[model samples]
Target chain A: MGKRVGLEVTVAVAEAVALCRIDMAGVYPITPQSHIAEHLSNLVADGKLDAEFVTVESEHSAMSAVIGAAAAGARVYTATSSQGLMLMHELLPIASAMRLPITMAIANRAVSGPLNILNDHSDIMPQRDAGWIAVFAENGQEAVDLSIAAFKIAEHKDVMLPVSVNIDGFQLTHMVEPVIMPSQEEVDAFLPPFVPHATLHPSRPVTMGAFSMSDYFTEIMKAKDEAIKNSKKVILEVWDDWGRQFGRNYKPVETYLAEDADILMLTMGSMGETAKIAIDELRGKGVKAGLIKLRLWRPFPFAELAAVLKNAAQLIVTDRAVSFGGPGGPVFSEIKSALFAQANRPAIYNYIIGLGGRDVAVSDFVGMFETVRADKAKAKADTYEFWGVRE
Target chain B: MNIVENFDLFAPRLINKKELFSCGHRACSGCAEVLSVRLMCKALGDNTVVASATGCMEIVSSMFPTTAWRIPWIHVAFENAAAVASGVEAGLKALRKKGKIDDRYIKVVGMAGDGGTMDIGIQALSGAMERGHDMIYVCFDNEAYMNTGIQRSSGTPMGASTTTAPAGKASSGQKTWKKNMPEIMVAHEIPYVATVCPSYPLDFIRKFEKARSIEGPSYIHCFSVCPTGWRSPSETAVSMGRLAVETGVFPLFEVENGHYRMSADMPKKLKPLRSYFKPQGRFRHLTDAEIDAIQERVTAEFNKLTQKAKFL
Candidate 1:
């Protein structure tokens, strides 16, 4: 038997090691991502990781503990699923605004609108503007790689924003795979110890989290926005540095086979693999097409996406979420806005598919193309359609 | 740190500044919560930022554009002052770390009503504390949800008349005793937790100064005398607050690292609790039996505190 380690194993090991490299972690239990916390608890319990494992009261407490531990200049970490993420939703904005460089793993799942707990982007989608640096992982290896990368990007002097590493619930979180685990010394060499710019200490006292009046409230918000905006360059630099260390490169938007294609299919999370297969099959059939995987959701890759879409005749943007009453899915509207300033932007179409873990079959891709071809046939058709579901 | 150390020896000199509390705001004329705010402002000075929840203090201090806060102040929502403060703290730290802002250390304070602190806010407060954030959380316990009409909060004293705990027919209003929050805070084992009242202005100011000086989560429970909710003459607010402790109903104390100390240790053979209970219009309808029950409960709780302190 040829021994093999899957990508999922790599993700869990990478996260566990990163927490060790960073220092302490406090977490509570939640679905689709319980293994990360469990591994952490075992590490701390078994005397492997020298850190505090606080069995917090709830998910709210879990996030709270991270904030506390993180503020204390510890490289704090935690993991949760959709509902747990929502339970900590009110605190997310707080953590982000506070500029805590906490790295959390979120197993993307459908929010309970009508009793749903399956894989979807809805959970992380709602928290887009909560001022977090949100990153999506397509596979198990990327999950591990991106998680380590998240710590660097978040703790950057210019970008002291909380970062969330989201993987597809059950699809990626529960998948068993062999992974190449990095050694502690190499990881330490790569990720330096986190030194907090501001923290609570008994000796050097300073007040934090104070009230702001009309004269300064807007300025405070402006400062946060500016910091996050400037973080793009820092994020790219960190990615480059990580690639140098681990020999794996990450881009905000990954493009495949778009050189001379008339159509482009774009997506994020695990389903990007499915879209990649569909794109490959369509290309073999002599349909000029390409695939784009969006890795970063927040500090959205607007400039990059627009640049990639410059030569496209038509774009099929797949979203695993809904905006309820909006024109298209949430990602669809965002993509349109990203291209709004570009003069050479191509026509974009938003396609909602694979929601609630409904199988995104090959026919789904065919349906997506049919809609695009229909749009090409009619010059003035609407910009979006919900795939695999009736209007 | 040196300045924090120095301020303890001498009463902090107040820098001359414009009054933050506006004239036409909606607080009771003798409201201790507003007075505490004014005093805290004087001590914290203009360099500080204040965040308040939707309570008596927030309602009176801010109204969109018109605000009593001359210094930087924010009000995000109820039950999130601690979480919001954590954000502000992180923001300031990042700013300082990046050298974007000057190194003049600013103090952050979060004030909430009792309902906000003792109930809904506990989550955020626990978080801020667990994060070990350096900030002060002040709960102005008027003993009930005074802002949204006189409803019974967890802090509402037993046998008291609240709209939610009406004393008609079979019920005696407010069936349970006021939750001992200072003790609960002590359970968090935070560095500093104190109970204060504006009636004793110096004590209240000292408590604020102490809490602000502590590094970690320091809780200060201010006994706010709400004239509107308490059904008493507004002018008698200060006297009632004094009687609260004098009668051992609300003992002013500080618990630092589990060291329980009373603010003013009362006579062993104390005045009847009725003197404290009978005056308030809310307590006017409490029967002799109910009053006796409340008095016994209060006395036993007070005695328990003394016993713990004596042994410790």
Candidate 2:
């Protein structure tokens, strides 16, 4: 990693493309994602990757471009953020429902309200149902690594759903890191050419996304449901295979100091680093606290979450997006539902933190633990709170 | 209506127990949407998937988990029927190349109401046309947004009373004329474009068959008369639709590769527009001047269409 100094993040993204052996990259210009596209476009232009890079007008078109490319028997890729991601909001579910092995990178940002744009997970929370395998990365190294792994996982014969590699807006997207760039020869040896089980070839055409009357309605959804549920094993196999090749363990949810710990905090994206610090600090102060970094979101990692949280006395979830009119943030609701059937789950809390690029500091985590204790004692035990905003 | 053998039902071409658009819908008596759907299914057969938008037809057929479609079907959100169909078409195209699917039987078709077609879905519709995917789009024009209530849409004809375009002192009903969606679609210069009425089943089926046979983008602006939306009895949903064509209010025509052909030749002895509008409460408030204006406009439009079709 140290020997690979003085390299640009854009080059790292291109190296990811080679590692994944992306067939078609459909992209539009929006912050952060543009560099990935630009580099890929240059590579395709120079005939390095031997792939198709379609430059679309909008994110809506970007996603549609990939939909077309993917359906046409291509391992499709794309990248967008914020407004661009929102523009593609409508097509996301269509991609998943149609079951295309499409992979995309989301340079996460806050949605526009007062016209502010910066790094956050708010751009992606509202789109949980779009049926993509969504994962958050803490650094550029993970972005490069996950992008390669995503192609393998999404293109797995059992799982034909889309996958998204999420990185914080400018934080990880533009940040320089010691990314282990694998050569194209090594990548070719590692990842095989994408052989789509269902393509839109004229020689033999089959109807997809057909009109399903009452008879096959449940079955159609059941197919997707089963695909997503069964994707767990494929995810594990891909992760293990990738880790073996790349020498990094990117589990669904990795535990830190949780073997004998209590009061565990669950986090995702770049915020995991902050939560890790809070865990170390609390342990230093003799508090039996730990951290769980949620590397995978879609396919929810429910079993792993339950196994980690069932023993803990108190569980806390920190989310970057504010899901209005609901029970706090998006993570809170999903966590509750995942544990709903579990026998006597622990006292859990949902906290909205780092919204609209607001910093989620170490003191905020410390304050959150104290608030959890005080609120539970006072019998005013709400399941969630905002970390950075005023009441 | 007795069941007759040797009816030449196109059911042989369809896969056994494989109906793309399943029946058992609560379509109003003589609802033209039902007939149009049946004919379209015959043309598309088991090789196509339909993206039906939210409307009277979708409500009666697809209610949550239950659907009136036997083939691979989907109902993404409203106003996205075209966009989703575009995605479906692209996805199927990619998968087939990947050796994941079979041949070209998997065409994409989007079914939408007038509101979904002429207005809310226009952008998506245009985008699909511009993209040039091999697909068929059927705009079932019922004149109003019936699923929501009898509300005026861009396809609502002049002098028709809607909830919003009511017959009042301030307005003589829908003062604006129906937008020419077929012409708009033709402007996309797609491979095929047609206008068909459900009253003539053979002609409607033939038009759809032609649209489906072509390879690129095609659109069918089907005249789907809605008795509920038109403020008329359910029994008149079909006859009223036929009257619309006979009165020159709606023309049965097809335009392909920039050539126009009137599917139904206008008879020399034509019924007046009054016969078409008089039975419905929608156009009841037309004054002598308003009626004259509508009559004149219809005559002119009919003549223009006849000229184009005759020339072709």
Candidate 3:
């Protein structure tokens, strides 16, 4: 066990990467994610972390450099938010396709059009199909824990794919929170030295990221799909191992009093903590409201989510970003699709809330439950409704 | 023995062995770009890893289930070869420091086309060079985007006809001059920077060897003639490259430690620019006035380079 210290979440993440003893970091600056890059650069410059900090020009190059480093068998990391993540969009799939096992921290923020820089899932939503093992952290503690675990999961022999830890912008990244900083020995014991499956070596040379034709492109994509899907097994095992070692058990879909509740509210990222308070309030007033927080967004906990939502008669899903004209929100569409085939599924009602960093109060959650319970059929099962839209 | 005698005895023996970039690849007949890569790869030898950008060289050398590269190679994306090579160099440094691998140094090379290096990839290239990574960056200049059906590129010289900058009633093909890449790299103040062509294989090999021997970043701009993109007869690729140097359209030179020197002998009487431009169909649309303008610019650029090379 290491000492608990009050550290900003971004700094906490940088310290966590330092604990892992990464060989190099390729970083470019973006708002809300700049502190992580700044701290990591300081760590390398101050000789705290013996790593090569390549201050790359853009997010595209940052990803490219890390892919090169990871291909050369170095444990590497980088972080970005919003537009930076979008800029790295082209190389994200390439990183996973090459099986580089690079761990990226996405300070989740809304994508630009109005150019708003606030907490939302819009950044990571478009990258869902980029073939990375995506995980969400509800708070600073989870951010630290999952940031460390991301390397373990990504570098695992069975799950040799890039992993992204999505932490909410400003809400979680800027907050100062007390976190248990794992010691060097603890982290070393947990994460073994990264042994690359296939590295670029002159002695025993290999070809990586070969250009594929139509004949083999489908099979190659199928293999990547299977690799990410099969990673769920290792994810669960690692979570269990982490729980046993650190005494903080994590799950794919975590529940707060949802075992017997008739109504459930689903949330992801930092908003889950706020929804937990709403659930408590609803429970106190005999409304039987509960909360289900999704921790793993990719290789999504489909079975766990179905099992949890099976008992509830109605479920209110809180989405931080809107899908705009397609469905309602990205998470709501995913949940609807996940429960569409089930025979005994909950009537899921999605409320697109907290977009562009819009504040959602505890009373809003109670109101959402009241509205859903009173007129479940009026909102319709196919589409979603906005919670606090100005009329 | 004199240098010419040593080269005569050794250069062919060095390049004629089993090729690092093997023969069965799908490069077009008389493709000078692939020839440049083949010569570069042969010079780099076995202790090298290549990070290639998305271009004709990458696509032709590596089409899945088959690879022409016998040594380690990677293609990350179009505009990131230099950045990726920087990572590879750094990664090898870390791994070697940890004693996880053997002590011998491995060379990392970045290969990109003019489009990948000059236009979309310029930022990454500049960043990598400024950082001074121990890597070699080779910008195989074919003047236009040949891999994407001959689009105009920044490397495209003025008055050259490309698909994107076609010679029409109102336009005289590409409007701008070629972006000076070697000077750009020289401005980064790295240890080694050179311009070579596949027409002179001995010079290309020697430059690559010198580049790999250097301690910091080295940039090599190889003038690779694209027979298809240039709309020239396939057989004239090597001849066109030779004419380019003799005509002062492309100069063979090297800059080491801020000192510049011409690698190839200056033509006794500089060949008319028409001797170089007339052979290629790309410049066929140029009128006498445009040709005079091009000749004036080429001679002026050559004189400026000669003045700088006097430092040698």
Candidate 4:
């Protein structure tokens, strides 16, 4: 058993990385994500972590450096947020296409234009098509666990793809919670030393990141799509193994009072925990309000989502980021597409909440459930509303 | 160092027989850039990893299913070669330390074109050098964005007409002087920085070998003659590089630990700038007054460099 200590989520994540024994970390500091980078660098400086802490100039270089390091057969890590994640957007797909097993932690925050640095899903929404395996954490414990599991999932021979473990910015990252810091022995058992599939070495020369013209671009993209789609099996296997060892079983889509419910509320990231409380409050009022928390964002748990949402008559889907001039919210649009062909699809309503870290309290979620119940007769599924917008 | 001493300009037998960069690359017929890359590969030998940028070299050498590189090479993107090389060096160091890989010294080399090095890639290059990674970054300066088109880049010399900075009734070619990338690298206080051209193969090879021998970061700016982009005859590629040197437009020199040393046997009196410019059609539109102004600027820059060397 590992020791349970009250530590900041970012510090716990850093400790988790230390336990994984990564070979190198190329990092740059950005708001809400700076603590993770600082702690990692401090670990290297104090000799607690035997790794190269490359303080790259920008998030672009951080991503580039880790791609290079991972290509050179090193287990590499990095972290960023908001504008930094935007900066790294260019290389994210390149890393995935090269099939380098690089792990990164994204402190989910709002991107600029209003220049806000707070909790939101705006940072990671743009990276949906970057071909990386993305997971969301609801609390400190999941943050640490998912971060450590990220390396295993990434370096798995069957799934040599990069992963991004997204933790809600200041909401989850800055909060201190009692987390079980897994021992090095446990992590070592879970993740063996990385055996790279192909490396940049003189003895075995291979060209990586070659330019693909129209001759082979479509086939290469199809291969990448298939690779990510097939990685779901390994993700489940790793999660099952982690559950067997750590006593905390995790699923792609977790539920609360969801079985046989007529109304369901859906959320991702730290808001899931708050929505759970709302579910409890709604159940007390004799409204069969269930909750669905999406944990896996990439290689999205489509089957699991459909299964959980089978019996629900209505669903209140909450989104932290909006898709301008297109559909309601990014997640809302994807869920609508995922369930478009189903025979008994639930009436879905999207409520874009928590723009730039406006607190989405328990009462707010209960209000959404009540509103959905009241408007059940005339529920317009195509439109979305901003929850707390003053205008 | 002794390997450089044995290098004879005329004797082909003295050069290493191993060709790390194989022939049959898709580089244009007389591409001096590819030749420079080939010589650099020979100098570095087999124990090297190359992180290339997205440019003519990467596209030509590494088309899918057909690679001309015998040494391990990677092309990540256009502007991150230096950063990638830093990661490669650090990765190798960590692997060797952890006994994950054998404890043998492997050199990390970064290659980029002028647009990759001086324009979009300058920040990454500066960061890598400032961090003092044990790597070599060679910027192949053809003075324009040759891979995309003959677009103007920061390395484009004055009075040189590129597609973007075309000489017209209103404009006089490139408005600004060529960016002094070698001097900018020297400002990083890196251990070594050099300028080489394939026209002087022995000098180029010697400098690459010396760069490999250094323990910290080294930057080499090679003068690559682009015949198609420059609108010059394909056969004049080698002579174009020679003319660049003879006219002091691109001098062969080295800066080691802040000490400058011009290459031995440099012309005491530089040839006229017009002799160097006459062959290329890019500069054909330049008026005599424009050529004279460019000449004056080139002479002043050369004098400044020589004066620095004298003090050293």
lDDT by residue for model 1 over A37-111, one digit each (tens)?
777777767766665555565677677657755654667777887888988897788788778898988988898
Least lDDT summed over 10 consecutive residues: which range in candidate 4 chain A? A374-383
Two-chain complex of model 2, DockQ on C-alpha atoms against the true structure: 0.13
What is the clash tally of candidate 1? 15
lDDT of 4 by residue, A304-330 (tens): 999999999898889999889877899
Give the candidates in order of TM-score, highest first. Answer: 4, 3, 2, 1
| Candidate 1 chain B least-lDDT 10 residues | B1-10
lDDT of 1 at B256: 82
TM-score of each: 0.75, 0.76, 0.97, 0.98
Report the alpha-carbon TM-score of model 2 versus the true structure: 0.76
Error of 4 at B175 (Å): 1.0
Residues B1-312, model 3: lDDT tens digits: 224336567776667475899899999998988888888888888999999999898888889888998899999999999999999999889889878778988999998999999999999999999998999999999999999999999999999999999999999999999999899999999999999898888888889999999998999999999899999999988889989998999899999999999885456557999989887899998999999999999999999999999867
Model 3's chain A TM-score stands at 0.98
TM of chain B vs. native, candidate 2: 0.91
Give me the candidate number with maximum TM-score. Answer: 4
lDDT (tens digit, per residue) of candidate 4 on B107-186: 99998999999999999999999999999999999999999999999999998899999999999899999999999999
> Which TM-score does chain B of candidate 4 obtain?
0.97
On residues B1-312, what C-alpha lDDT tens digit does candidate 1 reach at each position? 223224335444533245644466667777877877787776565556566676777766665445576666665567867765565565455445545456777666777999999888887777677667677888888999998899999999998899999889888899887888887777888899988887776677777778777777888888888878888888888778878877788887888888887765344556788887766889989989888888888889989888777755
Model 2 lDDT tens row, B1-312: 211122247435432334556677767776878778877886677777776776776777756445565555555555766765676676565555545556456777887999999998788788878878778999999899888888999999998999988988888889798999999998999989988887766667778888888998899999988877777787887688778888988888888898988874445555899999887888888887889899999999888878888887
